[model samples]
Target: MDITQLVYFIKIVECDFNLTLAAEKVHITQSALSQVVSNFENGEGILLFTRKNGRLNELTPAGHVLYRYALEIVQKHQEMLKAIKNEANKLVGSVRIGIPPTLLRSYFIPFLPEFISHHKNIGIEIIEQSANELKALLLDNALDIAVLVQPAALNKNQFEEYSIRLGEYAAYMSIHHDLAELDKIDWSDLKGYPVGTFQKSLTSYHIVLKKLKHAFPKAKIQFTSTSWEYLLETTKDSNKIVIMPIMPKKSAKQNYFLQKKFKESLSFDIGLYRPLKSFYNPAEIILHGALIDFFNSGIMK
Candidate 1:
């Protein structure tokens, strides 16, 4: 039945079968209300009400069923309206975000608390995966946004980009290690010790791997873990170096974790990637703004 007829039917029942009162409440003439309900009954092919001697009485069984379904449909329509209004009033929605593992530790994890607290109604899901997997997920509609490292070496058509151009990170060796004695360690310096890093799939890892042949062609690759904790624990005794951005002074309180910038640095752009067409969503805008604000206020950049 049409919305107007459904509303008229509901009003007729709610006003206790008083056609005069129902029509008065809905600001429609009694004849118009009666005619509308008559049209609805004809379209539905069922009698909605029993009229006996100019008095409308109780509904038939079929009428009761239609009324119940009609109530549900009207309620659902109202709910949809409420949801739209709520979305417009405040940024509130679910957004799935994919980020590579290394960034989750050093970037996303540390900044999450503030974002969560501020946007209490907007739910953010963070999927930790490699950059390649994240790109695929974004294209598949499995993810709303992603923070990936560039140059992704993938097709530009797949993702729209928001570059969080935090500066270069250096290949760092331990302070007590022999390479640390030099003000600058070149490609030749990393030759002897075991090479350690997050994962070979990452953008930064590939960059360093490219230069490894120029410096230490014979270097052995060992101790690969996605966890930052593994690097912290292993670096104490193993003297294995990894490439990372210099941690800010606030993190200097962590005794084992020391960082320094180098002349020979690997530049990285922490990127926010999503299907370009989806960026207009309000939830996406709020999240992107939050990330930009978080990094800008901090010393990590």
Candidate 2:
């Protein structure tokens, strides 16, 4: 009936109807939470949850309907409060951002100094994890924004996305490697070579692994790492072919590695992603705009 009850209801559902867990999350006693839900059901004369053997089983049809509306109402309520607070406080809040390890230094960190300089009042917290991990944190509402290498099969409805750059996977090898002379490397060309690439936590790893397996069923994946430096070092002196996003031209030249695109391009878009329903405070809005502008200006190129 009230916003507090609605919040409790949403948390209960999100916790899979576990009253104990929901109570813990909301910092209340289990018996008190149970009594609140019982009172709400009694007052409204509605059976919101189905119970079996004195344990919550699932939401009733009416509960499902209420859950949907509750989410919208709570989000709007929070947004209203944030808007008022931001107006009174004036552009001061922390923004929690997630970036994958592989793209941290190469893609995002270069723009931070300037962004921080411009918004000295805003505090920025950076979380470095793999792309898969970042996605999980975003879904759990732990990250305000994430820099993701947008996969081909991304669920567009879950997040609002702004494409920053378009790129594709490429093969890297020592300059003296046999395939280094070729402008583009075919999947079949790596038949006998040991392969190295990003760890399974990255979307790129799965993309490249699938293509490599399809093209050569017996291909050997000898090394898997989250560190690009490790991959580069592993490939520099050995016969291992590293498949990853195309590195900066300067890095490739200095590292003495040849970059060759895949004959069949494995492409992706690097973008900023935020939960579609989440409210963005002033700090987050400014940070989002700054990131888009930074990428659009082509300073990283």
Alpha-carbon local distance difference test for all models: 0.73, 0.84
Q: What TM-score would you give candidate 1 relative to the actual structure?
A: 0.63
lDDT for 281 in candidate 1 is 68
lDDT of 2 by residue, 211-294 (tens): 888998866677899888788887776788888887666555655677889888888788889878657788888999898988
Where model 2 places Cα greater than 4 Å from the true spot, the runs are 1-91, 151-158, 277-279
Q: Give the candidate number with the greatest lDDT.
A: 2
Clashing pairs in 2: none
Give the Cα error of residue 50 in candidate 2, in Å.
96
Candidate 1: residue 273 Cα off by (Å): 1.3
User: Scored by Cα lDDT, where does model 2 land?
Assistant: 0.84
TM-score of 2: 0.64
What would the TM-scores of all predictions be?
Answer: 0.63, 0.64
Highest-scoring model, TM-score: 2
